[model samples]
Target: MARFFTLEQAQQLVPEVRRMLNEAVEARAELEESQQEIAECMRKAHQMGGVDLDTGRLVLLRKRVDELGKKLKEILDQFEELGIQVKDLNIGLVDFPTKYRGEEVLICYQLNETGVGYWHGLDEGFRGRKRIDRDFLDHHEGDLVH
Candidate 1:
């Protein structure tokens, strides 16, 4: 039998998942900044014949870049650990696919909110997101691994 979740329960789970995704976004931003810095350093090094008094600085920059890369990986792993797969971010919502009730459900989470109160069928659009009800939730509860 499939177990269903109440709106309150689903709402409760959204906060932690959202937090994990936000952390991943922050990590990605940091990684991009680190990459830009590394590229700039390399550009400068090339301009200086690949060996200059700033060689030591270049080495440090490379190390920082590597660190940022590792951090990004770690963040991504953490996000996955939390069962979040961010597929898109537009306006203020982050869209992703998640399992619910033995089926793949498209969930859209508001970045500024705590709960994922909106979702839709696999082939449905935004308007397809029906209000979560007891019967629907019950049909899919057994599918919730988390």
Candidate 2:
């Protein structure tokens, strides 16, 4: 079943969720960098007549890339287990799904924010966020995700 979160519940989860997100984001960057380094190493070897290759260095790079990729995937799985939507790893955007005004909507938060303060309709995304306020809270209903 899909998990739902209330504004208060989502806000309360900021600290832990942010930490997880940061770790995932860092791992993601490292994984990308690792891939680039491996590619560059191979390119350099091929360019140099495919001889005098640094096999040891290339092997280490590949291993590091695999490790970083595994770490990234683990972090992503943690997010899935938590049931929060990871919208953008680059920007650290996440969405908390909950009911407002008898309709499902999303409460949005970005990496640098202290707390979630915005929400938007299901069809409207980040660009459509509106500030969370009394009206929004008053209209909120449904079971909150743990």
Candidate 3:
């Protein structure tokens, strides 16, 4: 069975989650910029008769690009482990599978500071989040396994 969290609870956790996602996205952007620089260097190298000042610089650029790629991969892996999905590179959102009662649910972070209290159904809007029921709250309080 899946466990459901109240919208308020979910909201509380959003700020922290959003911060993490933002870092990941920034790292990815850096990686992309590194890749573009490497590509441009390679193109310049190829144009210079295959042996010139630009060729040596291209080698260094390639190495830097490789390092950025590794860093970006690590960041992405971390984000995945945290149940976050990169939708808009500019905005971070949590995309984790959750459960309410016995039903599967999808919870998203709105970057609010309410802590994991807000939640919506798979097909519901943010306005649809309701206060959790007593039974559900009790189950969570007891830390019961789902």
Best by TM-score: 2
* Model 1 worst lDDT run, 10 consecutive residues: 1-10
Off by over 4 Å in 3: 1-6, 52-56, 83-90, 110-146
Clashing pairs in 1: 3-141, 3-142, 4-137, 4-138, 101-140
Best by lDDT: 2
TM-score of each: 0.62, 0.92, 0.58
| Model 1 per-residue lDDT at 19 | 66
Per-residue lDDT over 52-131 for candidate 3, one digit per residue giving the tens place of the 0 to 100 score: 44656667767777776777677667656544443344544454455666665555554433444444576764556655
Q: lDDT (0-100) at residue 130 of candidate 1?
A: 65
Better of 2 and 3 by lDDT: 2
**Shift in Å, residue 11, candidate 2:** 0.9
Q: After superposition on all CA atoms, what RMSD does each candidate show versus the true structure?
A: 4.8, 1.8, 5.3
Q: Which of candidates 1 and 3 reaches a greater TM-score?
A: 1
* lDDT string, candidate 2, 1-146, tens digits: 67888788899989988998899889888888878887887888889988857889889888988898888888888878877889999999999888888788888999999999999998899999999989998998646544
Candidate no. 2 TM-score: 0.92
Q: What's model 3's overall lDDT? A: 0.57
Candidates 1 and 3, the one with greater lDDT: 1
Q: Relative to the true structure, how large is the alpha-carbon lDDT of every model?
A: 0.61, 0.86, 0.57
